[model samples]
Target: MEIIFLDQNKWIELAQVHSGRIKGGPIAQLFPRLVAAVREGRVLFPLSVANIMETAKRNDDVSRRLIAETQAMLSLGYVHRSRAARIEVELRAAIQRRFGIEPERMPTHWAIAPGFMQAFEPMDELMASPGELARVRRMTSLVDPAALYLNYMVTQDDTRRREANAKLSEGLSALVAQIEGRRARFASESLDMRRRIYAAQSWVDHLDVLNRIVAALGYSFDDLSALGDSTMRALLEDVPTMNVEVEMATRLEAKTGTLSANDVLDMQSFYTAIPYSDRVIAEKAAISHAQQAKLDSKYGVILSRSLEDLSGHYVS
Candidate 1:
């Protein structure tokens, strides 16, 4: 079955509509089609650890049912330790090629113990010195920041957890404000036109580099974008995978700016989908990050916001 990964917002939209919190909107129309598609085995809606955490944040019955329903329909998948190691290796090469920044030594995947596997946190440059940032950068690139942060918070000494939490909170606040500010600006009719023009230009510049990298990886540019579920899965199985999300966050750090804890977690959700799903259905911010990283084209995955768009694109 074709895999379709939904962002947390889409799940919440479906849940709220189901509970009659809102009536007769596009989500109402979209939700049923998604359910039918999943039920008929036309697609697979694989949940991730990120989905579980995001849904668990809300205590309402609607959110509870949504989580349970998703779990029932599909098993939750995570970034396996082995896969993460491969991603880290490729990530280093991509960074060197694209940015000319080379690490002194290859970063090791954070899979020392069973429990440490698949855990990661965003590299908070603000909290580190230049030397420290370089090391932290490699470590963060290998694992999910949310997982790493959470593991650090719970398992570390009290003094360390306190420090990490403080940094996490500060980073999250800054990122949240940044996204909110962007939302407010883009919401304005006067600014919307200029915002779209700027965003379009950013995509054009980023995609050129990304497309070149994918081509260097021996994937045909045209064939890569047109891959179907089975073909895409086979291709990924045959190649080394890079953490496109982290690479995007790293490269676009100057353009897209620093990320918050929530932003990192949101990213981890899409990153998890890279290996486990055929397409990633997400919000503008998430989609933009992937596009900026050129992951959609590079990895041959469909990234779209509209459920209708996906429906038309993924007809079985």
Candidate 2:
């Protein structure tokens, strides 16, 4: 099946079509075909953590429910792992590739579970009696539409939403402040200099992923510290998602537009979707950013803003 990552806005548009609020549009035209493709097992729309978080933080319950229902039906609750988890997976493979060793393969199946897997919180496992566990397992179904809806609906709870959104607001404020601060600091640097600096800084920024990768490799920090600058750059280039993230950041950071949380979320979405998904249908800005980095060509992904363009594929 073709893996397509739809941008949150596109998903909303499709949601409108599904809700019959939109009578005519590219998304409306494409809706039934897309659904048939999904039902036929010819195409799969995988949800990103961005999709879940963005939808959750919306203030409109009707709109949220509309989107939640639409996504639950189409996505069947498939979602990419959290950002750290995704990078850790890619970093591990990048290490193996550097050493010319065949790494453990990626998960062959799209992630499927209840919609809670799409949430930002970590799931706590519970101990259950063997017979009870068996009974619950038999009853558990990832494909249950209501379960997925309820998963997203949890975020709509007033107290929880306020708590979650407060943190998100703080993050957004800090991100914007950080960018403006960096822009002022780099005011006199040449474009080339800034790009180079950002590329190097990108590696340092993902220290968490690097830490996990080192531990998994059974190596101490000092053991790999001597790999040298050039060697590190080469390994990062081989790491598809990191390469995409850094390249996109360099271009974006060079620009003068006021940065927002949406931009960071787009980067998060692209970092995962551009490298892994066969087709990435995202917003115009994100698509342009990835294209500017030549990510689509390098990664062999069909990156487009037009859902109507999807007409040619997955017709079963």
Candidate 3:
């Protein structure tokens, strides 16, 4: 759609009227007539036209009077609410792209420059000067006359608008590249951590096997410090098949009222094997620690390790 740029002086006039200095019936009566001229396409300048109409609507005394004047000026033809609405939609999308969020959704008042940035690329220097551009970026609400005037000013300069558009395009591209890089890094780290977790799991399973052997033997490990290192290695090697033999020996010993060599082996295995619960708790703590490390790396803040510590306590 073709857009007519408004003159800067017209904007200044609208701004003055908005400031409430132009008082009384004559100015109020002239307001509606001026609006009708633009609405009828007799006068053109998109920004000025919108501003004049908006200003009139805001002034209660002027607005009611203009309604009568506007009705008398023409047949009241179809108002271009849809066109205005479309502009508003485009403006909002542009603002979102520039700010990385929807302008209307922001906590602060919005302005036209940010909306323009979303709509067009900004000049490199202008883009770099966030403080200056911020004045324009926060034009979310149309209620502010300053925001409306800024929008009018931006529309008047094709060169500035083009520069702004280019800057925004460059900024968005850079932002996307940065996000993708971070995502790739995270995925790589996650896979590596998964491998470590599996290795830890294997260690735990081995520990559980040793515990089962010890339980079957029904031997106390309290006095195992006397056993030689070679004897301990032999007990560890026999953990897999020791359960049934250990149980049988325990029964035989109960019947005969005497402990055997096989039962002693079982007791040794039990002492060396890690408990399944202990393994699980350790694995969980490791995962929790890894997660906190990742978060700290990403956000530059250390998260509480309390949850991981708590999980370990429960599992152990």
Candidate 4:
């Protein structure tokens, strides 16, 4: 099935429409068709952890309720499948081999929400289980350490304005708080270190994802190293997060860009979407960045700003 990665803004738009806050709006009219596409299995809207947390931050009950309703309608979009524990270890190792990431650093398992293992029955059965629901809730997060590190390096060389940098600082703060909380839990009387382990290991999985992208493009590390930075970025590698950063650098050098934290976060989300998603609906700026990076030509990801536009393009 074609995976549809909806941007947070589109979700909010849908929620606003579905909640009747934006009555008779053109965007609102598109919701039913989008839902039909999902229900028919013509497309899948997988809510990224980022998508969930952003939705959760809504202040109004109407919006939150709409989010819940939308999630339920899109339940079949959850794509994670459980493999044998031994197979998982082998997969991680194989991914490490292709990516050149150290085996020690690779996560032994995909990061799971608390008690996800206990809920690992068949997908259909697990979907109704409290454990599965909890796992989905736990997976909601916004921290992207790999992207943050690259942003830090890029900011150092570009013009770093405190106003423009504040968002980046806030994101970093959130990431730190998450890690500290995990550390505290792991150090306490509780011996359950799964959360701590998963948190650290997930980043390695992110790297492995980049490796797969590079391999699919038929580029070796040496080939990537020698390519123009602009060319290398088209692959959407997050640890290096070269695509958006390169754009940021160009804009900064040309005195045309003000790097905001939201831009960085959006870029991270877009990058994360490409590997698993067949299409990505995101903010116009993020889509433009990806287009400039040649994402469409390289990875065949359909990047669009409107859910309606994407639906019409793919579902007709």
Candidate 5:
């Protein structure tokens, strides 16, 4: 029986019907129908096959079933390794021509469609580069080498940024420790000398440490920012911060007012404005209230607020 492309509703009905009966059909049964449909040029089954493969990955059972079905189909035809290799060479040449670089120099697999590979063969002259050979090897394990190379480049760039941030974190930790150690030593001096000698030294050490951390962070931020605003924003928003570090940094900045306007802008821009706007405004208001409470408790500076006053101001 010839299969036809079903409309959305018919497709949904077919899915419901086949969902139970085809629990684990032989691979040959599933794809041959589709492949035959493609061979006849009646429908575009390649896209359907690709879509099924992607969908299968989301569930193990589906993936296993799909793999079994595909395997059964592939077993029907004898795939020529030499033909595949020649096709790989053709693809490598195409890549080199497009990018001005050999595929093997790329860090990821370059895969091509079986049909495309079978249709083209590489000339011997195009097979001269070692990089091209290496690319062919990598592509053997991948679906598409060019796509894989692009993904690899993105991953490598992120990894480089993460390594830079890690180095900066280590530097900040050492500086913080050094400043704390200096403060402890200065505190151990005689009481009279402690107040006179350590007063300025203590504040200076604390400020210096904060300044260095902020400066290091700024440099890291600048490097990521150069990549793109979105990447920079994601890095800052998703960066892991220890509770102790966050609290300490906040207290230090509160005392020293060392966090500049630029730093605030960097952080504000990093967060998503839509969902975070109200939350951020509320948090800022809470901080203001907390500061007012501290003043009232310590300095007898009582402040009052009414429902009318609260409603009068927009959070933004």
Candidate 6:
């Protein structure tokens, strides 16, 4: 199946089409065929953490509900796993292969779990008898993605979502904040040099995660540390998400881009989607940054801003 990732804006447009708010535009023309593709399993549009969290910030209940329902239909409960989760898998695979050890296989469910999990770790199912548990599972195997989305997207009475969003936003800010603060120090550095410098720093920042996986493999972080600089550079490139993260981060810093929370979310979206999706429709600024970074060619994803780019999808 062709995996497609839509930015939250594109999703809103598609949602407008789905709601008949848009009747004769490029998105409207593309809608029916896209639905057919979904039913036939010829294509899929996966949700990302950015998409979910951004939608929750919307206060328009009607628009939020429409987008939620539209994404539910297209995504069918498939979201890219959390960035924390995905990089671990990537780190494990690369480390195991570097050591000539056969890699451990994780279930595909690890990559694709119920969307209600909201792109976090899989929640454990409640305890129950085997027969009854299986029966309930089968029934809710058709989980309500619409309801799942509405639960978070359409809340006015609760401080829980506001607190959750604040915490999640804060978690993403540290790396960007650290990198951005050092901008003046590196302003004179060449782009490639800066990218490499930041890449190494990014890896070091994430060493705690790598160390956990290293311990599990009966190895220590020093074994990974012992690799020559050239080999380490190659290993960094082998991990797609980090490569994009470093490249985009460097590009933004190069252009003296203003930092914002949305910038962090954009990074999250690109690092997850550009590496994994066949096509990515994101904000123009994002597509521009990725294109300038040459990420589109690197990942072989069609990075576009216009829904008309999808017009050719089902055409033969």
lDDT of 4 by residue, 1-316 (tens): 5677777777777767777778875676677777787667676665554554454444455555576466545533242223222223333444444455565463322322222122233322223367755544444333232222223223333233344345546775675465445445544432224422442454354566545545665665575556555533323333322333333323222222344445445644664455446778888767776676576666677788876675344344
* lDDT at 42, model 5: 39
Task: Provide backbone clash counts, one per model.
Answer: 6, 0, 23, 0, 7, 0
Q: What overall lDDT goes with each candidate model?
A: 0.52, 0.72, 0.32, 0.49, 0.31, 0.77
TM-score of each: 0.48, 0.85, 0.18, 0.50, 0.19, 0.85
48-165 per-residue lDDT for model 2 (tens digits): 7788778888788888888887787677766664555455567777776655568887556423233445323243012235664454345445346445455656545678887988
Best by lDDT: 6
Find the 10 residues in a row with the least total lDDT in model 1: 109-118
Q: Model 5: per-residue lDDT, tens digit, 179-257?
A: 4554456544544353334333433444443334335433332433355655422322122111112222333333322
Pairs of colliding residues, candidate 1: 120-144, 120-145, 120-148, 121-144, 121-145, 122-145
lDDT of 6 by residue, 257-277 (tens): 567777777877899889888
Question: Could you arrange the candidates by lDDT from highest to lowest?
Answer: 6, 2, 1, 4, 3, 5
Weakest 10 consecutive residues, lDDT, candidate 6? 120-129
lDDT tens string, model 1, 1-316? 6766777776666666666776886666665666667668566565555565554444354456554444333322222233344344443354344333453364332221122223232222322357755876576667554454344323445565456556655766776676556545554444335433334443454465446656656555565546555543333223333344434434333343444666766656765666445778788877886776667777788888865575343334
TM-score between candidate 4 and the true structure? 0.50
Local error of candidate 1 at 157, Å? Answer: 24
Q: Could you tell me how far off, in angstroms, the CA of residue 150 lies in candidate 6 after the best superposition?
A: 4.1
Error of 6 at 222 (Å): 3.3
TM-score for candidate 5, please give it. 0.19
Error of 5 at 237 (Å): 35
What local lDDT does model 1 show for residue 162? 52
Which portions of model 1 miss their true places by more than 4 Å?
A: 74-241, 256-258, 311-316
lDDT of 2 at 177: 84
Stretches off by above 4 angstroms in model 5 are 1-156, 189-312
